[model samples]
Target: MAQFTFEGDFEILADPQIKLVESALQKKGFTNGKIVVEPVGQKGDNYIAHVKRFIYEAEDGTTFNMIGKVAPVAEQLRLMMNTMVLFNNEIVMYNLVLPKLNDIQNSAGVTDDEKVRFPACYGVVTEEPYEFILIEDLKEAGFEMLDKMKPLTNESVRLIVKDLAKYHSLSYVLKNSEPEIYESYSNKLSNLWAIVGAEPEAQQFFESGENDLFKMMHDVSDQYKNVVRGSLTQITPIAKKIQSYEKGSKYSVIQQGDCWNNNILFRLEEGKPVDDVMIDYQLSSEGNPAADLLYLIFNCTDHATRLEHYQEWIDYYNETLDHSLNLHGLKANHIFPKDQLDADLKRYGKQMVNLGVLLSSMLERESKDALDMRVMTGDKEKLWENTMAQMNASLLDISTIVKIRQRIMGIIDTALEFGLI
Candidate 1:
């Protein structure tokens, strides 16, 4: 028998992780072959996990492909990103929550076309320090993520919110039908922001970003800038309230906590979106639908596009939610009414503005300035010493500063206009 070979970026993985992947392959009857695993997407596309695509070839000319997401190796990076908590939450999402949700949809006789799309977990390894999740590669199935730098078109926006309605509605379904099971998983998922809020580094990191944020506001009018300055005080408190277990409200559903362009993949037909698959549930948790709505809108689309269709998108999401609820003989008006939904939006909008600035900073980084894989992979003492130091306004180039300001300020303008701020 020929020995198995691991190639490319797969070499970075430790022995235990590589063995786990080999074991997973053996379980699929793929033994003794060339297994090539390489990093996925470009640098800075994702900051939290080290994602890679694994390819296997057999002598009979068969091919198997999948994606593996491993916890970042560096202890400093782990602390900075709340890596362990986020990884475990996603493991729960795939291994427990999503499967049950899909079964509920199937038992209701909902067609595959209408069900929430998620990649299948081929296997998972959580032994000690070597933790990784292997999932079906959406790229092999013809799904592609939109570019982070580009604004989503109106068509893309509609499909996203439309599908988002299906995804969020199921949480309500699971809650009503199987409250025990719902609570079991929801309770286990940790709130990343809430966890970080208690840390000493959190304040300094946020303040560093806030300083850069104001510097970017140089070209903005005094009226809007002051409105933003006033809202700053509410940010820390709002971050705590979001995904808050103590204050969990009736309107909260399991939201796709990171609902931006890159976290969702689209299957396009001739440049038009036909369907989408939800990815990156690392930050997903029991949260308000309004938070998801605001995230999708403010982070994915710019101010001009939103100024044209902001109200329309909200209306459409509510309508789609109502339609999806009817699947299980339930009523959205009874469970999550339009009035309640609108109230939640107003409640969460300010914090959305704060997070929008953070997202834009990551999205607009040029390739040269993109996250250095080495730093993330390196382990060193004094982990928290440089928290958010790189984002210092004086350290950034004029071009990047302008881009971050414009993207974030655009979100602010839309929020203020919609009365969300």
Candidate 2:
């Protein structure tokens, strides 16, 4: 059999990265005779990293599959993403955090089926300038991705929210049951938004879109124009605000930083989602869980579906969270309390509005217009000058812009009605 087959941009994967995967598999008692690698999904669309499936055939003919993620080979993207830290954080999540979480739940007598599930991480390599993660490939268990372009059904949204609740509640358990572990894990997690705040180019990128977004909001209401403009200009500080861990608050959790549709995989039966598994923890950090809820709604669901089920979605998330916490022998009311969660959502949900408009442009933009890391730099003016024109072109997708605008306007109207903004 041929050895070390590759597809897509897997060509750029260097020998050291491959060796890391082999070492990870070897540690699991899988001695390989030959290995095959194939690209799993679309690339470049993911501006930060590339993922591929690795198939290993043992000397006895037994074979297993692993999913691997590696930092981008593109020089510009690598520097822009601060991928070293991102890779290290994810490695810590899989190697350190997941095991602690599983142990905490198991000791509480929680059954594996009822608890939140994540892929088994086989091995991790954190050597600087060449990091890769190897984990169990969930596709072998029939998990699949929903089409990101389509609006999520309520059923799909419910499944996502439920799983998110289960995942987030573990942070609560860790904090109360195992404070030291909680502090250690929480402290290590890098706030993903802080990266954007540090990068002057990134800040200006958000600023450049203000006028375009303001013009889009002009027809909605005069106040909307002000709201949109204010949110856009203050993107850096708002991002910083969410980064606060707010220790001992009911609202805080070590949140899944990137909660878009593409970051999740679902197990569907008869065309309906039954369960989901989360992937891509590169942006994981401590923050208000509501930001995750709002991010998923605004980024994944179309305006119509989100508006139709906004309240129901919140109810479903809180219900699931309550269930998850009770399983850990912790009372949600005493520790987190459902009523406080409602208040927290109102406080932090504007992230959905601010990042919703800013990020949706990237989500909807043509693949060609995806951030070209090649020219990215710390020099704000140079980065802005090099990027602003093409960035505008990317955000000009009418369908995407309209849908995002609808979600933001809906959020604004509700905020105003509730005196939230």
Candidate 3:
């Protein structure tokens, strides 16, 4: 009913082509349609356009709404490899994993309610080098992005932990029940972190912030050198441990490889948070669940609030695991005893040290006036001034150096508890 202007460099289909597509739909039983393109949103190199509800004057005048995604040729080409990787992952999930699981369910004759934990896939269009997918637009479906730095309510935390447990449990079952499939998926998850770590850009980024972060972790290094020595001695082993986990018979389901808040979508039903849908599976592959949990906590929660609620969140994760395992006819004790889980929590928790340093550098706030603060292309002196100004503002609270120190000390304490250092 409402029309809006759409602007982008994406190739717009001609009126004739639009008519052909519409006619094709009409022949397939759709009717009374008018196409209006509405600008949706843009991220990185892609743009989303919406084809709103079509009103049909015939056959009860039902309205049908669909979405279309388009992007510039250059942008599409730039991200082609990344896009292909995600598409391949989706195909594997749909073709190899979902069907097998469904078959198993049918053979067992289990009538219990089982929901597929993924976005509804309508179809994909792949013509030549351009590829686009029509998917259920979660933004239009009443889902709000979770804000970083805001501590989640106990209820919301519970739901997240519960969903994670179920996800991990499913992966565990598939790993043992179908080893070949599990191995196939597992092989896809190579050490991507190693590649990133080896990059010169990464080295420069780390070097830029190392001195400030080192001062923050100074206390921990001083107080618990004996304990954290191992963690400090080898970044490679730490990187590997942070990437993979070893649980009895269960192989890791793809770690939501990137566990930042923005990558997760929370769905609320009846005024209560009920579900979490993880997106951007490009980096996903076999990994430790603890790494995901720790990464999310460090990146999403403010450092000032984390220590206060850390234990409670851990307990919530355990409770979710217990419930999910019971539903799947598995027991938590059989997979990870209470003692072992605690130990892993402590040991693997040191991985948060690397993550904390990374988050501090990346999440520092910059004002619009600080235009020269852009990390990629700004002049070095101007960017340094802007970064220092931002750090100074943070320092007025307790000094930027002190905050970094505190985070490092926190990591040391965790490492000591886990006997990792």
Candidate 4:
């Protein structure tokens, strides 16, 4: 085994180049420490190197445990300047949001409780080619990552909705309170979906895949063709809107650009759901709160359960949103009125539909391995194997599918009522 050592503060861990990172850490007050990289997790585009526990003695002869994260050069380069910008934004969010959350807890007059909505941020450091973030290790907190295809319990769904409401409420409050900072950071988000939709090759792949999804869409309801077609056509345009902020929407919040179950961590108290924690602020930006809601509901939940509890879930989310906003000295009608939320839900429903198509490619039973590997290596057999494995894992009960179809139909009917198609 090989060991790496660094000096200075722990923030210099972000540099892609190891030597510079070591020098920066040394400068920042982390001398007399050893660094060891361990494989913890990997996504399609990025790999995480977990810096194992470190021992630091205080003046009272007490030792504290700390950890760090480092990314490979390729992943570091993908976002380029955008990566650094996101890092800085997260640092600001941590400093601002974390403290305000504490204040909210003490005020008693506060609307939303901040026990476990956001991750515990130790600190963040960014230095050019190397960027490192020190965060409370989630694994150490007794939370386990759920499999991508596993169905969430009804309680899990409710908790997720509650946390999302609080998250959106916070962003809306921040936007009104600090427009300059919100606008500056929110403007940098990249809409990769729109970009891919524009590419000829990507379009072809989606067009072919659309037929399969259409089959699934039609099996659920007769009216979905037009809805699907319209959504598919609007993919590029919606992508553009997502790329920039829309005018006249009074309420704005930092959108958890990616809000799948995989990105969430849950803390269970005595086997009952107690708290939910959100991660991956890399995709955080200002956008419609409904976008995150739709994303999570459509992508993470099972087709059957979602369809069965769709209406209830929506209502619950609204209630949560209202409650959260009220705590921040705001009202749901002021931020997202019933009529506005419905309209946004319909318009944004199309975006979710478009996203569903993209997500299905990676989420369906046959696509599991590809997703696990975090890459599309153009291997059809592997894709099919992974997809089937997911399907098997999901069990795909007939009753579940039928119920899901009916629920999906209800959503389509609502969209039709709103003239979204």
- CA lDDT of each candidate? 0.79, 0.74, 0.50, 0.57
Assess candidate 1 and give its TM-score to the true structure.
0.93
Model 4 sits at a Cα RMSD from the real structure of: 7.0
For residue 36, model 2's alpha carbon misses the true position, in angstroms, by 2.4
Better of 1 and 3 by TM-score: 1
Tens digit per residue, CA lDDT, model 1, 81-192: 7777888888888888888888888899998777878788877777645678888899988999988889999889998999889988999998888888888888888767
Best by the TM-score measure: 1
Residue 167 shift from truth in candidate 4, angstroms: 1.3
Candidate with more favorable, higher TM-score: 3 or 4: 4
Candidate that beats the other on TM-score, 2 or 4, i.e. the better one? 2
Worst 10 residues of 2 by lDDT: 1-10
List the lowest-lDDT window of 10 residues for candidate 1. Answer: 373-382
- Ranking of predictions according to TM-score: 1, 2, 4, 3
lDDT of 4 at 177: 65
Clashing pairs in 1: none
After superposing all C-alphas onto the true structure, candidate 1 shows an RMSD in angstroms of 2.3
